[model samples]
Target: MVKDLYPSRVNETSQIVRRQDPVIHNENARTEGPLSAEEIDFYEENGYILLKSFFQGEELQKLKQELDSTMEDHQHKEGPDIIKEPSSNEIRSIFEVHKDKSYFENLSKDERLVSIMEQILGSQVYINQSRINFKPGFKGKEFYWHSDFETWHVEDGMPRMRALSCSIVLTDNYEYNGPLMLVPGSHKWYVQTAGETPDNNFESSLQKQEVGVPDEDSMRWLVDQAGGRIDRATGPAGSVLLFESNTMHGSAGNISPYPRSNVFFVYNSIENKLEQPFSGKEPRPEFLANRENIQPIQPVSNKSTARS
Candidate 1:
């Protein structure tokens, strides 16, 4: 699974919760522009919704430039944020964008995103973390099936799953490029796969334990019973995907000629701010678990952009 994501607080146990909920989308809501009421409802019901071609052109180009330059500048550097693939040595992901450059600073405060945050989360919210995931063309790695809320809850001291994440596509996300895949409506069911908590932070803990993956039998049962479906989030270079933190998501290794790249912004409701990490591990880097700069965003008033 992607390292920079939020994990669930699936406690020490082995149980697959069977939550029976039927989802029906409302086709009457406005189907254009930013999220409509019906669209938001769909997200609430299914755990995620892809906004096709939500961004484009210059904005995407600038993000690409910032990502490329940052990667180039940090080549060979060793740290938690600059993670590299084990086999190909390609950069798997770059973490904490709001720390490294101003280009990513405006992402959280953009009206386009923040307004929707207000609608789904509430009037008060702040960014939890940010990162750019790179699934390289030929050697992109696989992110095994797991739930993000389990990590945030158990490791990061997040009390509940009040946060959500958005993936802003920078490069075309195709099936062969290992686009993200998720089990439909799996957010409501949590599986406590193992009986141990991570000894350390989320990223390092992933190396130490399986974290939150359910047993194979349970997964098969959930896929068939929990709406019996999986979705591949594929779209053009400017698409945006908003997903609940607890959702089950994973991706296969990209052995294709095209690479998949996307910038992620995780927003947590101010009402659900994090407490100190409960895991007896050392404190996570600020980039991973932000605590210092907790300010309610002023997006609508700012009309912000990267250039501004």
Candidate 2:
């Protein structure tokens, strides 16, 4: 069974759910825009870029509300581990929580999300998968360094294709709160390891070692091979991190007292054909559902805020 990260919050069993609005940014706001050459260069060189307040405050609040409500219901059926309180153990596999039609409907109508995605991947980009990562204060464990593309693909034999995973922070993320650590430009060095399988093996290694220190030199070697380029993605709520499918990244453990949550949406390019179905479940039944939902993403806006 997956461990509960926030025992206090879940055990109390209060129905009170917090609600807030999505914060809209005034910086270069536009419904649709093409990515500039320099912005593309940054992604090519850095493997990932942090987009500030990508979702409005209200939208984020609504999603959070849905997550909380679903998690509350999940606790009753799946045990106390499902609705962990702040400073509890990490909870895993939250997909089973409240798979309601309204949840899918709300996600489908997220205009800003859809608009930004369309700009980055063209109009053909589709939603392949959606997941919520709930990490409670001090109880949340570290997510080991790796790439998403290394795990997901068409079940049938086929050539590897590019994909994208978009992560939106629902709470403030700092080093102590388990901010994401990325190896810049590592996407270009992606090489399929012969007979290697994707699983928690990598995470196990991370759990046994200290943060910023890898037990195996191979991890260091990989980053060094990428010209020693690395960066820790830390930001407040609403920050969005978009990375290529092959980008090497990981996160530290949450040592803070505040809970951390991030909702991930994976997308693919429509031009790249899949040999078989990408997900085990049927399509989302929404118009936006498509095969290209998890493919590598192109930037829609040429203008990018300078990294602070």
Tell me the spans in candidate 1 whose CA falls farther than 4 Å from its real position.
Answer: 1-12, 18-34, 87-89, 201-209, 278-283, 300-308
> What value does the lDDT take at residue 212 in candidate 1?
56
Say which candidate scores most in lDDT. 1
Q: Give the per-residue lDDT of model 2 (tens digit) for 1-308.
A: 22211111112121211111111111232334444445555765676778877655566676678667766556545442133333443344354221245563345335555555555554455555565667778667777776555344312111243446778787887767778889886665533332222222223332332222222454676678767866887887878888876677888777789888777776655543344323222322222223333443332321121111
Question: lDDT for each of the candidates?
Answer: 0.71, 0.52
Model 1 clash count equals 11
| True-structure lDDT of candidate 1 | 0.71
* CA displacement after TM-score superposition, residue 82 of candidate 2 (Å): 8.1
Off by over 4 Å in 2: 1-37, 78-90, 96-99, 154-159, 194-218, 276-308
